[model samples]
Target: MTGAPLLRVRDLNVRIPTPGGELHAVRGVNFDLNPGEVLGLVGESGSGKSVTLRALLRLHRPPIVMSGEVEYGGQNLLKMSEARLRSVRGSQISMIFQEPMSALNPVLTVGEQIGENLREHTALRGRAAQDRAAELLDLTGIPSPRARLADYPHQFSGGMRQRAMIAIALASEPRLLLADEPTTALDVTIQDQILRLLLRLRDELGMGLILVTHDLGVVAQTCDRVAVMYGGRLVETAGVHELFRAPKHAYTLGLLQSLPGAGAQRQPLQPIPGGPPNLRALPPGCPFAPRCAHVTDECRAAEPPLREVAPGRLSACIHFDELPALRTELQEVHA
Candidate 1:
């Protein structure tokens, strides 16, 4: 923990205009990312995890509306001018997308891509930029950096491309790195290598990281804190150990129990009962109530506000107090 958070998101909301009406993609989401900490944002597809990250970077297109404070280094990113945001984006914060093939330029060499940021953010040029680019490649564990500098992205393997992405992201030495499923396309072995590389970079650079993914296993291995989102809202947040040890929200417990290794042999994994609620026509109460086995009448009528159930543990379920009993029963049934 530091004196003040490096990034603070307060009461964030994002909506889009649809033919039916407006779709609420995110609702009153709030969190903080401290320096040198890894915050894991986990949820199913369409849970607004990607949208929230895009909104932070001001990447959403037209018809998509956003309201909230994204405070970074004393400046509200949401309120900054386009020019100011441009100054902040690469130099102060960098983002890595899941698909490197799409993110990288097909026409440019790997060195040219990494050097682009250095040229834009710094005064380095020609030989200096080339040297720095090679250095970044080396930093990211890309072998034979000098030899690879002249190679195009298509010449590299999937893991190498991701490593190049990391090199580009680190070229600016940003204070924060937003990685959206950075290892999605890689094989399992390569995925582990990438995860270890990311952890190494975080330790060596002391930069804050936001790893957004649907894989709880990734979160368990790489994150210090975890936030579970459902229906575009944060339903639970806790330290990684606390969350895995005794999850407080039904959704959180379900997610943990649903892991492939959570149950016995030949038994089907118990997925969360129902699909995520529709953002355009969400229910009045808890968005997860329909799928939650612990749901009650109150859960259907009134939305439960996120409240602190224990020190540094917060859940949005009304029956969070009874989660322990429910967890035990579910484990027994699945055991």
Candidate 2:
């Protein structure tokens, strides 16, 4: 049986009104996630990765306006009423944020936080909710689940608190999971463990996952597909292996080349020059043009929409076809 996509985002735009002006945090982003599939939304800071994810959950506050379609299970979330959206948030879709300390309520015990969703979304009461909460904690590999249920967020280590957050996110058996840099503040070993836990949960629950991160290595290891963003726009989208092996967009290539082990001789890291353009006043042409090495006059005249450069691979660069091929210089550099 062919299941419909769990979540679909199309031409999404989000703007936050500031005293200075409206800051466009996300623009024209599009992607879909099928059940049991992980789609990585990757980019540098302020590249709209987190904004896109928050838009999916309808988590933005007032003065933060959002537009476009966020379809989930045939329903357009953008059009859902506040009450209906609340029903969807914890039960149908959930988010595990970057910082567990901030995300979790300090006053509530870990068990209470996990059980809060069960009580709100399900008919479970008292002991039943408590039992289910402990089960979730155990499922997330928290030892001594029963005893730890009484422990507050401050009592646990950083890694354990993150696991608690994941446990809460999974409490409602959400069909779509949004993890926004879920492993960001953890140690490498802890990060790997968290990634593995997420992958295992996805496989077992058959839930769609959107992993927002700056770590390309995490994307390569955990995602089936990836969308690369820059300056509030999607620069490229491709299957995991295809993107890593043959990144077509110049920005994409630069990202891959900038990876820790891209070349053996460890040539001076070639960072994409310049900071992200100010969202309040974007350039008339391609936002990446100023920083792109291969920019041409034509590229500075108009913005380029993401177009299919190959099967399942899309790039927004106008001169994507003429971009130089990236050779594996590891061997040569080493010799």
- Which ten-residue region of model 1 has the weakest summed lDDT? 326-335
lDDT of each: 0.89, 0.87
Q: Report the lDDT tens digits of candidate 1 across residue range 1-335.
A: 75999999999999999999899999999999999999999999999998899889888877788889999989889989999999989888999988999999999999999989999888899999999999999887889999999999999999999999999998888999999999896888888888898999999899999999998778877899999999999999999877877888999888877876543444467888779899998888988988899988999998999989999988998888787632323233222
Candidate 1 residue spans exceeding 4 A from truth: 262-268, 325-335
TM-score of 2: 0.94
Record all residue pairs in model 2 with backbone atoms less than 3 Å apart, i.e. clashing: none
Could you tally the backbone clashes for each prediction?
A: 0, 0
Model 2 per-residue lDDT tens digits across residues 1-335 = 15677778898999899999989999988887888899999888989999888998788988789999999878888889999999999898999998999999999999889888999888988999999999999998899999999999999999999999999999889988999999897888898899999999999998889999998878877888999999998999988877776777888888877765543456666787788889999988889888888889988999988999898789999988877665543333222
Estimate candidate 2's alpha-carbon lDDT, on a 0 to 1 scale.
0.87
Which sections of candidate 2 miss by over 4 Å? 1-3, 262-265, 325-335
